[model samples]
Target chain A: MKIKKRLGLILANTILIIASLSVLLPILWVIRTSIANRLIAYKIPPVWIFTPTLDNFRMIFETYPFQDYFLNSLIISTAASLVALLIGSLAAYSIARFRTGDPALRLSMLSTQMLPPIALVIPIFLIMNVIKLWDSMTGLVLAYLSFNLPYTVWILISFFQGIPVEMEEAAMIDGCSRFQSLIRIVFPVALPGLLSAGVYNFILNWNEFLFALILTGRNTRTLPVAISSLWTQQGVNIGAVSAATVITILPVILLTFVIQKFLVRNLTFGSVK
Target chain B: MAKSSFFSNLPKHDQQTARNLVVPAMLGIWVVVLFPLLYALYVSVHDWILSQGGIGSFNFSNYFTVLKDPLLLNSAKNTVVLTISVVVLEILIGFGLALLLNNKGIRLRNIYLFILLIPMLMPPITVGLIWRLLLHPELGIINYVLSVIGLPQPLWLATPNLAMLTIIIVDVWHETAFIILVLLAGLTSMPEEIYEAAIIDGASSRQKFQFITLPLMAPTILVATIIRMIAALKTYDLVYILTRGGPGISTETISYYIYKVFFVALDVGKSSAMAFLLLLVIILMTFLLMKVMQKTEQNY
Candidate 1:
């Protein structure tokens, strides 16, 4: 019985080790490739070790306008997500507390989440052009609002629903107005929900590529759009591209770990809970 | 309508508050999404290629143009195949991993979970880049490692047969973590008493899993499948960054095809029609998902 139990333990540990390595190894290789010499990139035998260089990173900054793109991504993602969360939370509160909007409102809002972005892009592209917002950061923000606002509203609605309505009423009875009660009492109660929802929206906004690809100019390109623009060279700038890839995703990786705890709960939301 | 308006009048303050709160969000949606969607329908009927010139009177020919195109059919077939393959593999592998790690006595639990989630957390563009670098025909780390192990190393994205398979595998690697998390949550939250009872009855581990675990996990499985299917159907960043509709369009899913038609082929009208079709398909999927969720809620 002792031997059998030991064997089972060993088997489980082995599978666990293999699974962890498989997930980590490819990702680790990206870090490896980014730091390696550019010439060693296409060698038949992969170089396990080499002198690391910051040349690729430097090149992206010095030789290309990559910093503009980086700044654009940071600003656009932060701004758009904030605006979406602001309006979405208001809408969510109204829905949760007062049962506002037409009966079809919630479904209609959610249906926006389901719309293929490609369909939306055509008219959006035209509208932005006519309004002189084309190839600008504002245009990208508006495009992002379509997905972010509805998603934020929906997620926040569920979160707001979890709070008891009587808490706000109790604050009201103590001399707070409806709006004052929301600010003093309800906001604090629902702060975590707002935060998790905001973080999720930020991540989504940061990761969005296609609209940024279509809408941004050379001056206003975001990270994902910048990654696409890397492919113009013929000989495969693998090292440089890998370096840019790391730069682009490094912030998200940091943010993801911060997000890890709230992720599964918020992602599966009402259904899983 | 009259009765509802009168009722609205009685709760005048509440109604004012509700409208104030909801209007910004509704306006955002109206300006960005609803209006564009309606305009897209308008554009779909006109021959507004690039929305400049070639503009003609409204007609239904663009729908026909999109439908009759052999490429759209090819891409649709590829999207279906890819979606089915990826979702199935995700469910199997995700559930298997969840079972493996669901043990209470596991070592380095948080570390393992964190590492597993790295692929899912990174941007899809970044995911695409890493895989593209690793799948490079001559010098990729994967091919080198495969050669060391005496395994076959066919040129991955460069070859037609391997391209689609490669895309699916990369997608699986990225998304399987989500399913695993969902399933693991389901697994851990499952009532422990039933398993204890089974053990008390002298049932085998396999028996306990089959009789008790699988049935309970069915709802989670359904949830994961529905979400993954919708996500898989809308795959774009990976297709764009990695394959770019290359190696004879083997990796060109519907989203990629839409980009190709509208941006590359410069046929705005036809692309919009296909886009609308995709919208209908998504709504149909969500409708199915809601039905499934409702059914499972009743059963479980």
Candidate 2:
């Protein structure tokens, strides 16, 4: 019995170690490929000993307006998320404090998230064209707001409801207006939830491809669109592609680290908590 | 001055007041979300072509055409398969991992959770690009390692069936963390006294899990499954980067097919019709899920 138990323990640990490696290896390969000189002809046995270079980084910037795409992504994602945060917080506060909408309205708003972007793309495309906002960052930002707003409202409403009403009541008794009480009392308490929602919204907008693909043309292309365009031209520059991928993902990965705890806390919020 | 004061003190509710309070946000959603949905529905039922001036006529021809298209039918099949495979695999693996992490004696539980979450945190495109390189038949680390072990190296993204399988593998890797996180939270939050009682009564581990843990964790598992299903249904970026719906359209999910028809093929009417169908399917599924969840809750 002792030997059998020991064998089982060894097996579990070995399986875990293998799983960890599988998860880590792909990321490591991307980093390696970004530095390698000739990934295309870089042998079947795998060239681990190749000298690294900055040529990929150089080529990506020189060939395409990679920096411009990066800036576009930054502006659109940040601005859209900020708008979503502002609107969603106000709406969520109203719902939480006043119970303004019926349960059906609340559910419907949440269900807007279930409405696939593909369904709306054609109409959105036509609408953008009519407004002469097609192929522009402004248009893309507005498009994203529709989806992100509902998500924010749903997540934030649940979060705001979790805070005790007595805290806000106390603020009101201290001569704070309802608005002041919300800003001063509820907002600070809900900061982690707000941050989590904001980060997720930003990531969603930043990584958005379909709307970005349809709505934006040459000048306003975001990173994902730009990466897709890389294939359109020629040469299949693996190094430059990897470098671009790394650059595009850096901010999102950093934000994920910052909000990891909040994400875990809130993932099971509505059902379990 | 008294007259002015009386005017100001008049009842606050008015048409102007009501519109002022609701108009801004209401207009924002109406113009962006509601208008587009209405317009798409209208367009889907018509023979619309933006290039040919505007909407041509109100007809069900586009819907009939799309429904009868073999390509669309194939795409739908591929999508359902992808969604089912990924959700099932993620649940099994995620539940196992969650159970393992929930054990009282496990060390570095937080570290394990965080590491597993890295895949989900990264953008889908980045995940796709990473896997694309890692699955390269010749120079990829995966095939290289396989060959080192004296095993045959499979062309993952190059071949059609293997491409679908590879995409599923990548998705499961990325999504399993979400299920694990949610289930672990559910497990940790479950009432402990009941479990203690079962243990005191000489219940075996398997029996305890089957009777107590499974029932207690059901709601959270349902929640996780619903979210995963919705996400998997709309998957696009990873497949686009990995295969571009290539190798004879084997990995062509509905979203990818919509992109091709709308943007690539520029068949506006057909794409709109297809998109509308997808919307109908999603709504019906969501309604069914909510109903089932409500019933389960009542039962509990």
Candidate 3:
């Protein structure tokens, strides 16, 4: 019986180690391919051993305006998210504090997120064309805001609800106006929720593909759209594609690490409560 | 008496005034989201390709043509298959990983969880590119590894049947982390006393899981499943990047089909009609899921 139990333990450990390796392999492959030279042109048993080089990185910069794409993505994602945070938090606070809207209105507001973005792209495209905002950063930002705002409101509504009413009430009693109390007292208390929402929205906008694809031309193309261009063009360069993927994912990976704790916390929100 | 009455009405006035302030933001949301959706529906029913001078005529022909198209049906069927397979795989793998990590004795639990989540954090295009490289039949790591193990390597993206499977596999890998993150939190937060009682009642491990954990995890599972299903149904970036709905249209999902009709084919009227149909399907599914979730929440 002792030997049998020991065997079972070893089996479980072996399975766990294999599972970990499976999860890690694809990421490791990306890092490896980004540095590989001459491996791209070869089809001979897929050599894993190769001297690493920055040739792909050098070619990527020379071939495209990667810096411009990076700046475009950064500016647009940040601007859209900040604007969404401002508008969504204010709306969420009012709805939570006053509870004045028809309940159906609030519910319908949340349901907007269920509307797949593709469904609205044509109408938006036409509208942007009519307004002369087509193929512009401003248009792309507006389009992103339309989707991100609804999600932000829903998420922030729940966050705002979790705060104690007494904190705001106490502030109100101590010569603070309603707006003042919200700004000075309630906002500080809800800072973490806002930050998490902001980060999530930023990531969403950064990673958005379809809107960026349809709405922008070369000058305003975002990183995802730019990376996608690698495939459509002739003479497919696998190494450069991998390099762009690595570069594009850097900001998001760093941000995810920063917000990892909060992400776990918020994802399980109503489950625990 | 008059003064007292005025003071008594102050709460009502404050509430009314607050509503007035919130009205602008609420209206802004409606104009930005709902108005465009309504307009899309309106335009979809008409022959309204922008290149053709816009709104040439109000007709049901566009909808009729799209509904009758064999391509639309094929795309819809492919989408359903993709969504169901990916969601099912994600749930199973996600639940397994969550349960494994939730075990108290698991070493490096936080590190494992963090590493597993990297796929979810990476942008969709990057995920696509990585998988595309890895699945390259001749020079890809996947076939490379398979051959090393003395296994016959399959052409993942080149074969039609295998192409859809490849997209599904990459999607499952990308999204299972999201499911695991949500479910692990649900498991950790579950009350332990119920599990302790199950042990005392002489339940075997499988029996305990079936009778206790499954039932308790149902609500979180429902939420995760619905979110995953919606995401899967609307999957475009990865499919677009990886296959471009290729291998002779075998991997074309509904969203990809709509893009082809609108952009590539420039058949805007047909694309709009297809978009409306896709919207209807999504709305119906979302409505059904919401009802189930609400019912489950009420029971809890």
Candidate 4:
């Protein structure tokens, strides 16, 4: 019995360690490839001992308008998050307090998240051309709201529903108007949900690819779109690609750490909670 | 001027006002989502290509033209193959990881979860790019390790069979943590008394798992599988960046096929037709999942 138990423990740990290593392997290679000297990166056996260089990272700035793409991603994601929050919070508040829409309407709202970007791309391509919003951050943010707004409403509804109403009633007794009470009371109380929702929306928008792929032009192209373009011109440059990949994902990874606790909650729509 | 007085009398009207609040967002979604959806339907039935001026005629020809092609059939099969394989692998790996971590008693479990989740949070494109580097036939670390073990290096993304397997492996690596979290949530929330009762009855571990854990975790499993299905069906970025439906279109799933027809071939009408086909599959899956989820919620 003791021998079997020991064997099980050893096996589980070995499996776990191996799994962890596999998860890290690709990521570590990307990091290594980013800093590896150009010659060493291409070596068949992959040289382990070598001088690391920042040339690829530097080349990103010199060779491409990486900064523009970077800035476009940053601005668009932030703007989308803010806009989604602005309208979504009100709608969410309404739904939480007043049970806003009928079942069909609410389900349709949720259904939009499941709508594939492909469904929108063809018409949106034509729509953007007619409106001349194609290749602009405004157009990208508008497209992003299709998903982000619904999500924001759903998440904030859960947060708002969880808050007790007595506090707002108490504010009403103190002569604050209904709108004032909402602003003064519920807003502060739901700040955590709002923050998490905003951050979540920012992450979604930041990672959006298909919309930006067709919607944006060369000047307004986001990072993912720009990254895809790397393959188009000529032979693949593994080092520059790796560095750009790391750079592109670095902020998103950092932001996700803050929202880790809220992920399952948001993902399951508070059902888990 | 008097917001409090305005709402003082009609509590019933508050609900009306609240419903009205949804109007702005509803309108916003309609413009972005529903309007374009209607447009897609219109486009799907017409002969349209952006490069060829526009909308040549109104007909069901686009649907037949797109659907009759062998590419759609090939991609549909690939989509099913990829989705089932990846989701199954993820569920198994996630369950194993969850059990392992649950048994570890919580101290180091979070660290493992954190690291395991890193792959999931990164941009799918970067996930593809980094893995592409790691799977490079010659210089990649994967081949390096295989050589060390005296194994033959298979042409991965460049080979038809291996390419499908390659994307599945990357997807499993990226998404298994999702199942892990869902199952972990279920595991942690399980009443300790149920397990204690089983233990007192001398229920073996596997017996307890089969009789209690599996039954209890079924709803969570369904939800996880459905969500993963939608994600897998809509998959574009990783396959786009990593495989490009390559090595004789072995990796071309529905989304990738639509993207090729829409962007590369510039066939708008056929692209929308294929898009709706994908959407119908997703909507049907989601509707079934939602029904089950609602039932589970009601029972709980």
Per-residue lDDT value at A74 in model 3: 96
| Model 1 CA deviation exceeding 4 Å by range | B1-10, B51-54, B295-300
lDDT of each: 0.83, 0.78, 0.80, 0.83
Clashes in predicted model 3: 0
Task: For residues B183-292, write the lDDT of model 3, one tens digit per residue.
Answer: 89889988999989989998987898899899989988887888778878998898898899989999999999999888877766778788889888788877766676
Q: Where's the lowest-lDDT run of ten residues in candidate 1 chain B?
A: B1-10
Cα lDDT tens digits, model 1, A1-273, are: 889877876787788789889888887887887787877766668766788898888988888777888899999998889999899999988877776754467656656787777778877987898899988888999999999999888778777878898998788899999899888887788898888878887888788888998888876789988887686553578878888888988888788778666677656544675
**Candidate 3: tens digits of C-alpha lDDT, residues A41-76:** 344565656678998788788888788888999999
Residue B247 of model 1, lDDT score? 88
- Model 2 misplaced stretches (Cα beyond 4 Å): A1-8, A39-43, A50-52, A231-234, A265-269, B1-23, B50-53, B289-300
The parts of candidate 3 lying over 4 Å away from their true place are: A1-9, A38-51, A264-273, B1-13, B298-300
The whole-model C-alpha lDDT of candidate 2 against the native structure comes to: 0.78
Model 1, span B40-107: residue lDDT tens: 89888877776467567889999888889899999999899999999999999899889988877677
DockQ of 1: 0.60
- TM-scores, all models, native as reference: 0.94, 0.91, 0.93, 0.94
Kindly list the per-residue Cα lDDT of model 2 for residues B79-141, writing each as its tens digit.
999999999999998998788778654556666666676776677877887777677776567
Number of the top candidate by DockQ? Answer: 1
Looking at chain B only, the TM-scores across the models are: 0.91, 0.89, 0.91, 0.93
